[model samples]
Target: MAGFRWWFMAVLVVACWMKGVAGQARQQQAPAIWVFGDSLVESGNNNFLRSTARADFYPYGSDYYRGPTGRFSNARTFSDILGDWLGIAAPPPFSDPTAAGNRIMGGVNYASAAGGILDETGQHYGDRYSLNQQVVNFETTLSQLRTMMNPESLNQLLSNSIVVMVFGSNDYINNYLMPNIYATSRTYTPTAFANLLLNRYSRQIEALYSQGLRKFFLPGIGPLGCIPNQLATGQAPPGRCADSVNQMLGPFNEGLRGLVGQFNGGSHPGATFVYGNTYGVFGDILNNPGRYGFTVRDKACCGFGQGQITCVPLETPCFNHDQYVFWDAFHPTQAANGVLAQRAYSGTTNDCFPMNVQQLAQVRPM
Candidate 1:
């Protein structure tokens, strides 16, 4: 009996070691991610188009990705951060031909600069890529995936993939902020306007959900009114945020939470919606800029607010980027983006929802 017990213990130890090795191997298999959204996801698609949304120039991707070839931001965006956390390289830009080889095992960026949910929004506005076009791009990529891999492999890709989105601010800024088409011609009150915008957004979300996408990380609005550009125009308090514009984002976020609830309760039990509470994250930074290593809270780090001094212009180049929360009046600096990405994954809400970025990550199909 003693001899038999000793043999059994040795067998158990070897089995445990083998199981640990298998688990480590599985972890090495990184999950693929499909990024879909607005200018935030723009990986130089705008450079090809005849639009002012182009970023295929200097100082854009210089700090991180480097060289004019890397036009998407300095280091990487939220999607890249998430991909890193998952142990995979950030998805390559869709325009890259090498994407075919990488995408079969990884993901793609389908975001277009100035993109919107409706096709007509971009045409009426001047430059943005309408959300419809983004969807078209997404579908095209899906076809490419189909051509590259078998059905079983494709299904595996779909099953393990994550999709992220950050949008709606463009519509507010371009249409609602100054009281133009959406408010006057469309006749929308603030509350009604939010509802209408959300309705359009819901349609887009539903369409994506229909396409076998179960994991979603959707960002809510940030402190838009406090942006350097907006502050330049509004009467901002010293070291504090403006109420009128910042307040608007709350209702919008609330409406989004309600929408997520509806989606979760509907037929798509497999679908998980994680709300990116960017507003709270940005607010935290605004409320305590010093804590986050920010100094220039009112103006862009790279732009001249007084006159024609822009961040990228020949005469008006950036001096110190770390002091500024925004690289420009509208966009946050890479540091800010990194903080927001961390906050998204952690789900540490300042005053938003129960789900954070980390919670949202688990929204994949079983």
Candidate 2:
């Protein structure tokens, strides 16, 4: 009987060990989220840069649990909310000191405030990382990952990961629109400028694809015309948005949708490109604010001079942030971001073209 008891104990130990090994394998194989974008998804990367566009102050993160973590929103950004829905922890910014070694296997966010698709788009801001630079940083992450994971495992991890990219707004806001500061407006018409951006953006996407990234979620720029910054211009009729600015964005959004279709139509093997209809979603909210539980859509929850300026450091913001759509002159409040992230994660064709993030997450690599 004593001999039998010893054998049973040995069997139990081996079984427990096998269970732990399986759990570890599953954890390693879990899909991670790699984020790359501009201010809308900045996450705190700009804190590490010597940029004037930094947001590491109070009122910026008043509603966030960590309080002023460099996020441009009052709480979580769009990518942060989306990551919550996916059950994936938001990755540390690529520039963070701790984002190295084994910690990188979880993922990395390369988003920077004032960033844009074109390198020169937001140069006036000082020290912003362009989309090209973000991609380069991603390559560096891939290199470090290669040291820890075999080529096959690394490729598998990357191919299964979801990449979120939000850009192009700054190209219009900071570059083309500011004709005195940038020659792009003088050099090209709105259509031509859109084409130029799409061309550059296409190259960036292809570059990422070449690096084994297969699942991409690209959220199109929202209605900049409706933001407090543009509305304060007095360029529109009373109770209306800056229609001229909104018109200029149409071609860009259309071209972006075309790019998604092109990518999925055999431009890149095993690639699943999903386009989030940010314009449509935000427009719907603007047109029907009450439907989305928002009371103020035309103004910002926090502003300084001219109602277009961003929230001043340590300045007090509106108490009812959830009722307000715009957080500052440009970004959305956490409440609005939650709605946008929810729709992008699971909404139908009207929200995200082809498939939503939830659907894209389930698709196996071709």
Candidate 3:
């Protein structure tokens, strides 16, 4: 009887793996979602690289995918969430230009961990990729896609698809915050620096629009002032956020919001911009963590006192995941991401909850 039970359990596991998840097989006719931007969307591209921003190690994927796929988080991310919502597999790695074509059945996550829009040098963050490289890789991926499908099919794919872009964390955190070896080390007021960033960001968005991408979901900065590492190192009153850091993010988000509105309300409507109020959602979580059923809202779960040391499982494992908002000093936990995803994909920008998954899907192509 014991042996029979063991065989039965094995069969059940195999069946789950074989079956389509989130209605993937049922929604075979839906269009693909093209993901772009930074580490927030990184499903596992860093595993192939020799970078420190890698999650291929243990405890990262132990929660969701069950094993290491090199994700830089404790479990599945927004990219994976989008896949589940779309009933298809998440996007493939940017390293493999042919990956998008291979996954032809689902969306593609072109986001690389540590990538940014304005910084093309790839030196801002160690072990992190650049935004330009992601776009370049995407061009190759698109060419491969063109080869795999008929002209009509390709056109349909582009027209019916959605593009999600989320970035700017590294630009502020790595380049502007701490002067890396490559920088000239100039001091400019936060306003000046933000203007510079916005200018560069505008150019990148324009470039994407020219590429026939008509549906855009651009997420603004989250609570940058609340991250454990930043708060621990930065000068702020006890229980108070670093107002200066959060201040800079507003201008950047404002510029993006204006651009989104321009495209959405313009005469030559080539793309529909869907604004993702990351700031609002993250702020809500921070101000009232109990609303989300979180216990430790101020400090990270894995890090040392006030989040100074390694927050990895071996170094210091968290006791209760759902009770904590942040998984590490830098990133949010899986449950937090799940809540964020639900908010991002559920309604119109005017909705009290901000943009949601359904609203993002409703973005009509140019």
Backbone N/Cα/C clashes per model: 8, 0, 8
- TM-score against truth, every candidate: 0.83, 0.91, 0.85
Superior by TM-score: candidate 1 or candidate 3: 3
lDDT (Cα, tens digit) per residue for candidate 1, span 261-363: 6776756767777666777778888788899888867777665642212246333436766667777656666777767766765655553355765555555
* Residue pairs with backbone atoms closer than 3 Å in model 1 (clashes): 114-128, 115-129, 116-131, 302-311, 304-309, 344-357, 345-358, 347-356
- Residues 74-106 of candidate 3: C-alpha lDDT, one tens digit per residue: 788766675566555676776644564457435
- Lowest summed lDDT across 10 adjacent residues in model 1 is found at 306-315
lDDT of 2 by residue, 25-100 (tens): 3443236999999999998888998898988998999988899988999999999878877767788999999999
Q: What TM-score does candidate 2 reach?
A: 0.91
Query: Which portions of model 2 show Cα errors greater than 4 Å?
Result: 1-30
Given candidate 3, what's the lDDT at residue 292?
87
By TM-score, who's the top model here?
2
Report, for every candidate in turn, its global Cα lDDT versus the true structure: 0.66, 0.90, 0.69
